[model samples]
Structures are given as C-alpha cells and as structure tokens.
Target chain A: DARVTQTPRDKVTEMGQEVTMRCQPILGHNTVFWYRQTMKQGLELLAYFRNRAPLDDSGMPKDRFSAEMPDATLATLKIQPSEPRDSAVYFCASGLVSTGGSGELFFGEGSRLTVL
Target chain B: AQSVTQLDSHVSVSEGTPVLLRCNYSSSYSPSLFWYVQHPNKGLQLLLKYTSAATLVKGINGFEAEFKKSETSFHLTKPSAHMSDAAEYFCVVSADGGATNKLIFGTGTLLAVQP
Candidate 1:
C-alpha cells in the first residue's frame, strides 16, 4: 500500500527556533497539500502544490512560514523564529485529480510540533 | 466560498448502538463533500465522499453518509457502533467549478464509544 511519509513525527523546539517538517508524497501523485491542526482552529490549509509548483500559500504566515516542493518527491514546510502559537500537528496529503475533477486525499501520519 | 459545520462537538454512543454524526454545509454552487476520521496519534483518514453522483455514499469500516441537497446536509451514519469507532470526525467541503481541490473543513466532532 502506498502512503505519504512524513519526517520528524515529533518535534520540540524553544520559541524563536526554526523548525522544518518534511513530507514524501505517494509516488505518481501530483497534488500535495499542507495543513495545520490545532485544538482551537481545527485544521487549516497552509499551502498546496501541483506538479512541484506552489498553487497557494495564502493561509500561511508569509513572515515566518514557508512551504516548498524542492522536487516531486519532497515537500517541506519551514517556520523561522517559530512562536509558541505555532505548536500544532502539521499534515501532508497527496492526491491525483482525474478528468472527472474529483479524487480522494491520502494523508501522512503528521508531524507534531511543540514550541515552548 | 464554502464552509462546513459539524452539529455536535462530541457524541457518545454505546457499543452495538447506532451512530450518527450530523454535518451541514453552505456553498454558492454544487459542492463536493467528504467525511474524514482521525484517531488519536494518527493521520486523518477519508471515510467517504459525495461528488454529485449518488446521494448515498458508502465507505469503509461499515460507515456511510447521505447527501441531502435540499437540506444542505451530508450526515454520517452507521447501524452499529464499535469501540474502535471512537475518533475525531471532520466534515469538509470543496469549492465548486473544479478549479482546485482545496477544502474547507469543519471544527470536527469527537465520537466516544462506550463499552
């Protein structure tokens, strides 16, 4: 079974530290999404990429957060000078949109970040 | 723009009993709705989806949901509940016109199964 793989399943960092989370989307999938989950905000879409090109990153804080797909197999989310409020579980999902215009997303185990 | 609301923040059901998790959505045009379940320490898993074909969508783990356009609802249901069914369930809506699959998610409902 193919699955999206995420690195640093758990991360603990002091405030102001830089944190990087990595994801390896399923082979052959072209669409990748990054989402952050928090108890107060539920799940918020941070960014997404299609064919290794970022389609949107409006939900992410441009000042501190950055998302990039260096290549088709690797997608990364980085937070420079991370704050305490940045603590959340970040999930990466991959999917293939068909001609029908609909498809299901396969999610990674998620990287749990705890900023002190 | 589209949004989803999960009616209950928490739902408790005993094993062998029926299960119901209500969801409502609002969108300007026809929308694609989905149900996802997240277990503790696990990633979100797709339960089922309704993409304008069949109103009644069946999913894995004996769960299913029906799309009611008139009611703007796609509520998840199961005949019998099991202990393993305890998890956080999210209702999501996708934008119309197939531009992108970006989704708007609900706050989520926490299901508790009692033995």
Candidate 2:
C-alpha cells in the first residue's frame, strides 16, 4: 500500500533554530504539496511540486522558508532561524494528477512542530 | 482568485440525525469542489468531490455532496450522523478546467456528534 509518509511526528525547538521537515509522497503520485496549519492562518499552501520539479512556491516566505525535492521519493521543507510564529502543524500531501484541477488529495499524518 | 467558505463554524447534532455541512466557493473558472474531513491529529481525508460528472457525489462513510454551479455551492451531507463523524471539515476549490492544481481551502467547520 502506498501512503504519504512524514518524519518527526513531533518536534520541539527553540526560537531561531533551523528546522527541516521531510515527506515521502505516495508512490507514483505526480503532484506533491506542502501546507502549514495554524490557528491564525488555518491551512496555507507552502509549496507545490509536479514530476519532482517545483511548479509554484508563492505561498512560502521566500527569505526564511524553502522547499525542495532532492529525489523523487523525498521532499524537504527547510526553515532557517524558524520563528515562534512558525510553530504549527506541517502537512505533506500527494495526488494522482498534476494539478489540483483533477481534484482529490491524499495527505500524510502530518509533522507537528512546536517552536518554543 | 479561488476561495471557499464554510458557512458554519460549528454544528452539534445527536447521533442518528441527518448531517449537513455547508460550503460556498468563489472562482473565476469552473471549479472542482471537495469536502474533506480531518480527525484529531490526523490528515485531511477526502469525503467527496464534485466535478462536471454529476450534480450529486457520494463518498466513503455515507457522506455525500451536491454541486450547485449556479449557486456556487457544494455542501456535504450524511444520511445519519455517528459519533465517529466528529471532526473538522474543510471546503476546498480548484480550477477544474484551468492550468493550475492549487487548491483554495475554507477556514473550516467543526462538527460534533453527541451520543
């Protein structure tokens, strides 16, 4: 069975620390998405990739946040000097189609990180 | 721009009662609408989706949704509510016939089922 997998189900870090969250999307899925869930912002798209290439990342904070797919199986979100405002649940999701226009998203369990 | 709005912030119903979660969307182009449920500390699970295929769409766990293009609404419903149905529900929209795959999500509505 193929499922989107995420690491560090829970993480606690001090403010201004570097944080790296990783995800493994479902096998053979063409689209991968990164999202951040916060009480104030709800669920916000951080980045999106298709065929192992970044298609859009306008939702991310350019200076401090970066997302990359080093390989087909691994997608990483790096936050340098992560702020307390960045404390929230990060989710990695995959889909069958290239664009959400096709509809339906398969999501991972999510990686919860608390910035103290 | 595409966006979704969940009409209700919270709804509480007794078990075995009918369930309704309202959603409205705004998009420049025709959209593929969806309703997703998230259990505590879990990921969002697709409950149902509405494209051009049918006005009414049925999904897992007795959940269903209707796409009213004219009204720009896709509301989720269930025949009977269960305790396990308690969770956060999100209404999302994406351009079905457009170029991008990005999804715009609603703020979310919390549903509570009482035993």
Instruction: Specify the highest-TM-score model's number.
Output: 1
| Native-to-model Cα distance after best TM-score fit, residue B9 in candidate 1, in Å | 0.7
Clashing residue pairs found in predicted model 2:
A99-B101, A100-B101
The DockQ-based CAPRI class assigned to model 2 is medium
Error of 1 at B112 (Å): 0.5
Tell me the spans in candidate 1 whose CA falls farther than 4 Å from its real position.
none
Which 10 consecutive residues of model 1 chain A have the lowest summed lDDT? A96-105
TM-score of 1: 0.96
Best by DockQ: 1
lDDT of each: 0.92, 0.88
Highest lDDT scorer: 1
DockQ of candidate 2 against the true complex: 0.55
Fill in the DockQ of model 1.
0.56
lDDT by residue (B40-77, candidate 1, tens digit) is: 99999999998889999999999999999999999999
- List, residue by residue over B37-78, the lDDT tens digit for candidate 2: 999999998887777788999999999999888888899999
What would the per-residue lDDT of candidate 1 be over residues A1-116, giving only the tens digit for each residue?
A: 99999999999999999999999999998889999998888888999998899998999999999999999999999999899999999999998866777656889999999999
